[model samples]
Target: MLLCSLVAIIPLLYSVDAEQSLSANGKVLELDESNFDLAISAFDFILVDFYAPWCGHCKRLSPQLDEAAPTLSSLKEPIVIAKVNADKFTRLARKYDIDGFPTLKVFMHGVPVEYKGPRKADLLVRYLKKFVAPDVSVLDSDSAISNFVEASGPHFPIFIGFGLNESMISKLAEKYKKKAWFSVAKDFSEDIMVSYDFDKVPALVSLHPSYNEQSIFYGPFEVEFLEDFIKQNLFPLVLPINQDTLKTLKDDERKIVLTFVEDETEESSKKIIKLLKAAASANRDLVFGYVGIKQWEDFTETFEANKKTPLPKMVIWDGDEEYFSVIGSERIDEEDQATQISRFLEGYKEGKTIKKRISGPSFLGFINSLIGIRTVYMIVFIVAVVMIIQTINKDDEEPPGVGTREQGDNASSSVSEAESKEYRSGEKED
Candidate 1:
C-alpha cells in the first residue's frame, strides 16, 4: 500500500511541474489567487503584473509582456513573466496593496519590489536583466567592456573603473548595486581612455550614455569620496523632468535648480540646458533639471509658471512643497542667459532668493499615488467609509442624561462590544 501511494504521488508531482512549465512556455503565465503563491515561490526571479482585464493600459501591456517573455525566459538565469487579473482577485490585489491597475512588481526570491522601469518590450527585458546581474561585472577585455556597456541599456548610470583593482569598488558596488551598474575593465587600450574621456588609468569614469555625458574622477578611492562621486553622478548633469524621471528623484536628497522653458525641442531650450549643465558640473551639491511648459503644463503650473512667465525661467526646488527664486536673476535674457544663470546661483548661495510654497500638491504625491483617477477614487471611498464609521461611533458614545445611569452603563457595554468586534475584524484582515 505504501509503495502504491509513493507511485501515485510521483506522477502527481511530475504533472504539477509539467503544468508550471507549460504555463511558462514562451509566454507570460496568467495567474490567480489559487496559483499565485505557488508560482511565485517556484521562481527565483519573476516579474508579476497586477492588472485589470478591463484596463486599456493592461490590454496594451499584455502583448508586450508576451513578446518579452520568451527572450527573458531563455536567459541563463531565467526570469518568468506573469500577471494576475487584479479585478478578479480583489483579495490578492489588496494583499499586495494594488491601488492601481497594470501595476508591475519584480519578485526576487519571493520578495517583491515595485518595478519603475519601462514597459516597452525591449526596454523591459534590458531593465529586468539588471535585477539578476551580479553586483559588479568583471570585464576582461576591451570588447567585453564595450559589450557590457551596450547591454547595460540607457536607464541606469554606469561606473567603469579602468586599470583599478576590483577590491577598491567591491563594497561600493554592493552598496549602490540597485541605483546603478558597476564594473571594472581589467584589460583595455588608450582608445578606451579617450573613448571615456579620462586622462589616465587608475581613474573611475561615470557614464550617463542616455544623457550623452561622462565624468571622470582620479580619486584616492576612499569610501567617502568614491561614494560621493557615485551618488552625485547617479543622475545626469542636467536631468530632463518627466513622469519617469520624477520617480527617480524620490530617493535623492539634493535640491533641484529647475528651469522652465517654453518648449524643450526648441534650440533655445537646448542652449539653456547646455548652460545648466556647466552650472551643474560646477555645483555638484545641487541637482539641475528642466521641464518645458508646453511639454508638462501641469507640473510647471505648480511652480506658478505660465505663458506670461519669462521663457527659460529658473528656480531652486527643495523637491517638496517649496522653491526659491533669486530676486535679480528672475529672468534670463537670450544673449545674457549664461551670465544670468551665474547670478542666479550666486544670489541663491548668498541668500538673495525668496522662498515660496508650491501652488499644488507635491509632485511626488502624484508619483506615489501611481495610477491617477482610479487611485483618487479609492482614496475618496476609503475616507468616506472612515468618516461614516466615526460618525456612528460618536453617536454611540454620546453622554447619557444625568438620571439615566443604568442606560449609560448599557450604552457603554454596547460600545465596548462594537469596538472589540472592529478590532478583531482588523486583526483578521491583517
Candidate 2:
C-alpha cells in the first residue's frame, strides 16, 4: 500500500514541479543562457529579473511583474520584461554578478544598470516610463523655450544646450532629468544667446527663474565637467540638513560646516544662515548646512549638542577624518561672522582646531556599543542576581507561628476549660 501511494504522489509532485516553471500569465519572457544575450540585445530597454525558484521573494515578485507587463508594453517605446533562473543557469548568473535572488537590472542599449527603486508595479512602471521619452527636448524658437519653461514649474531648473542636438545632450539629460529639465536649440536669437552670455556652441546654461539666477558652462561637454558645473551652481550656498541633503554632503569629501538652529524661521537662524552663505562662497572647499534644533534633536545629539549646548551653534564635521569641532557661538554671532568662520577654517586646516568623537545618548551607550549583543546578557545576569538576592533576603525572615506567650496562655486556658467541662459531664452521667 505504501509503495502504491508513493508512486501516485511522485507523479503528482512531478506535474506540480513542471507547472511551476511555466509563466504566471505568459507576459514575461523566460530567457536561459542560450538566448539571454540575444533577448537583451533585441530590446532597447529590458528589465531582467535574475531569480531562483526556491526564493520566496522571487515567487512574490513574479506576480507583480506579470501584472506590470501589459502596462509597460503600452509605452511609446515598450520595455520588455525578462526573467532568468539564476539557480538553473549558474554561468549566466555569474556573468551578470548576481549575488542574490530576485536581482532586477535595467538593460539599455545592451548595457545593464541595476534597478534600486521600489518593487511595486506602479512605481516600476512609472520609473520605466521616464526612459520612453526623449531625454532632451528640442526647442526651435525663443517661444518654444518660453513655452517649455512655462509648462514645467518654477521648481525645476532648465539646462539649455545651444547649437546642440538631442544625441549630443541626451546622456546628460537622461542622467539629470530627475534633477532638472533639459532642452536643446540649434540656433537662437543673438539677443537671447547674449542675454544668457552664451559665447560658444554646445554650451550648457542652467537657468533658475524663481531666483533670477543663471549659470553658463562653455568648457568641454564631458560628463564629469558638466556634472560638476551643474552641481556646484545648482544648489543654494546654505543647505538644510536632512536625509537627502546629508547623503549629498556625505558623498563628497569636503568638510561640512553645519549649524544647528533652534528655529529655522527665526530671525537669528536666518541671519546665521546668511552669514554662512557668505563664508561658503569665500571657501568653496567647505560645505555649509543648517538644521532646526527642535526638529532634529536626535541629529544634534549625534554631535553631542544637547539642551546644555548653545543654540545656533556651528560645527565642522570632517567626513574623511570622522571627527568634528564645535565653533563657539560668540564667534558665529559676531559682527564679522564670515571672517570668524574663515579664520576657523584656516585653523582647522592648520590642525590648530580641537577635534571630538561623535557622542551617544549617554555613557551607557558607549558600554552598550562596546559590549554589543552581550549587553542583553549582562542585563539579564544583573536582574537574575538581584532577584536571587531578594529571594534569599525574603527566606531569611522567621516563619509565621505563635508569636506571644499571652496568646499561648489563652490557648492553654481554653483547652483546660473544655477538658473540665467534659469531665463534669462524665461525672453527671455516672
lDDT per residue as tens, model 1, 1-430 = 9999999999789659755564556688878876788888888889999887666677788899999999999988899999998878989887887766678999999999888888889999999999899988999988999999999989899999998889999999988877899999999888887888888778999998888899999998898999999999999999999877887898899999999999999999998899999999999999999999898887898898878898778999998778999998887889878888999999999999899988755444444344543455555556556655765566577755533555445655656565443322221000
Among the numbered candidates, top lDDT falls to 1
Which residue pairs show backbone clashes in model 2?
none
Model 2 lDDT per residue over 56-160, tens place: 678788888988888887677888888999878989877886655577888888988766545678767765665555678888888887776665545556788
Each model's C-alpha lDDT?
A: 0.83, 0.68
* Local lDDT at 63 for model 2: 84
| C-alpha-based local distance difference test score of model 2 | 0.68
Clashes of 2: 0
